[model samples]
Target: MEIVLYIAALVAAIGFLVLCVSLAMTLTSLKKTLNEVSGTMSGLEGQLQGVTRETTELLHKTNELASDIQSKSEKLNSVVDAVKNVGESVNGLNTSVRRITSSVANEVEKNEEKISQVIQWSNVVLEIRNKWKERKAIDEGRSGYSNFKD
Candidate 1:
């Protein structure tokens, strides 16, 4: 009976020791997995920070571009206004030219009869001068006197 009791006690102690060794190995594996997970989380955090910085920079650039576009639009508006003013000035010049042309036409219309009368008067004066020259030559030939008599 003593020998049997001793053998049973030894077997229980060996089984207990094996159980403790297995538990220690499982705990070590769990700790290693947790450390790997923590390392991956730290890398993800760093990448997220980089993405955030890029997004902020992109926003700032977009704002600057928007401001540039707005300034250009304002300048374009001034150019449009200047073009409109030029068009108005051209319209006014066209009106003035048309008015001057009409005034010239009206004056020509009013003086058409006067211009014909003046042409008739010039013809009459030319005829009178021709007659006077003929009379003077006839009188001079009859007298037979030298143009310069002493």
Candidate 2:
């Protein structure tokens, strides 16, 4: 009976030792996994910081570009306004020219008969001048022949 009690006590002690060893191994593996996770989190944090900085710079550049475009658009608007004014002035000039042309056409139409009578008088004067020249030439020829006869 004493030998059996001693054997039972030794077996219980061995089982406890085995449980402790297994617990220690499991704890060590869990520590290594935790360390790998910490390292990965640190790398991700650094990458996130870099991305934030680049995003900030890109946002600033985009704002500057927008401001420049707005300024140019304002200048372009002024140019467009000037072109519109020029078009209006040209339209006014065209209207004035049309009015003057219409007035001249109306005056010419009103004086159509007077213009025709003036043209007929000019032709009659030209015909009288031609007739006078022919008479002078005939008188000179007669005087020359009489002198030859004498």
Q: Which candidate wins on lDDT?
A: 2
Output the TM-score of candidate 1.
0.47
Candidate 1 lDDT score relative to the true structure: 0.95
Per-residue alpha-carbon lDDT of model 1 for 1-150, expressed as tens digits? 999999999999899999999999999999999999999999999999999999999999999999999999999999999999999999999999999999999998999999889999999999999999999999987666655552
Summed backbone clashes in each candidate are 0, 0
TM-score of 2: 0.62
Off by over 4 Å in 1: 1-41, 112-150
Give the alpha carbon lDDT tens digit for every residue of 13-131 in model 2.
89999999999999999999999999999999999999999999999999999999999999999999999999999999999999999999999899999999999999999999999
Clashing pairs in 1: none
lDDT of each: 0.95, 0.98
TM-score to true structure, per model:
0.47, 0.62
